[model samples]
Target: MEVVKELKVPIDYLFDVFEQSIQSDILAQTGKKLNENEFTGFEYVKDFSKGNQATIQIEKYERNRAYYYSTHTDKNKISVRYDVHSLDEETSKLHYSEEIISNGFLQKMNDALVGLVWGFLKKKRFKEMLNQIEQSYTE
Candidate 1:
């Protein structure tokens, strides 16, 4: 999945907001602290509901420009990337993409069917979150 959006905030601000969000989420989920200065190649395990867990790795980290990561689970490997471009002094473009690879035939089939049903909802929610971020920054 891929999404692109124009944000009403500078690239630096957007990147900082995104980094803080990720750090807080990781800390909440895994009880781990992330050092922003050494974010690249950082790895941690995050626990989910129902005792599920996944290993998350920071694959690429470029301040104010790009952040890419991968999550490895027993059933799937998921990669996500966020790229930010400055359009002007107070505007930026954000490009987001996500890919998932299933480890087995059944999981692949299930993922396809579930993605067909839930993909739009997920995208909508993500866009809403971005909008909220922009609104907060602008205010």
Candidate 2:
């Protein structure tokens, strides 16, 4: 389950907007929709690290950075890695690939379906989040 999306904004304002988006409550809302009760944050630390025990939390956001995190699946203990890459200063690409531990056709199908639904939700949520950020600049 690999989902990718790209968004373009002004190069000069991109970092500012991106930083604000990450620090804002909008990210928390997105996290709630993406992860579960067990892991619901944008950053994982040494003390709070879930290790390789199947976490569903987002990684820390470095300045002008990209990150990947493995999080528990919504249905099972299976975990998936969400990878993102910041392209240029104005564009960014996101990839949410569902990691399949089991090599079964059924498992693949399940993961694909989950990815589809998650992808749809992500696009909607990201668009809404961006809109909110833009609105804030005006206010």
Candidate 3:
């Protein structure tokens, strides 16, 4: 699955926000609903400022794109990439693509049964991250 949004910030600024968000608990709270504990390993990293947690990795970074991967303990993994396309010096389009992969039979069943809700929650988190970046632009 994939999620995309148009952000009104420069690509450079988006990268900065991403780096900042990872360093804090913002990423730990990504895709967080009112009371869900489905996501793990995003918090408590020894050096999240570098974006490598127990189950998350940030890589393939360039001027306009970055890839992030996160895994749940039960063999469910999410690989997502952010592509930023500059429209002008001050605006850019953010395209987020994600793929869910699992090697466990239980995980596959879970995905088939609750994937839609999970996708919605993840999309909500992506928007929240964009909002965070936009807010930081004002500050």
> Which one wins on lDDT?
1
lDDT string, candidate 3, 60-121, tens digits = 45545653545444456677777778888888788888777876898888876777667778
lDDT by residue for model 2 (44-90), tens: 32222453333345443333443334445433444444445567765
What does each candidate score in C-alpha RMSD?
A: 1.3, 8.8, 9.1
List ranges where model 1 is wrong by over 4 Å: 29-32
Scored by TM-score, the top model is 1
Residue pairs with backbone atoms closer than 3 Å in model 2 (clashes): 55-71, 56-71
Ranking by lDDT: 1, 3, 2
lDDT of 1: 0.90
Which regions in candidate 2 have their CA more than 4 angstroms from the true location?
1-54, 57-60, 73-104
Model 1 pairs in collision: none
Q: Is 2 or 3 the stronger prediction by TM-score?
A: 3
lDDT of each: 0.90, 0.49, 0.63
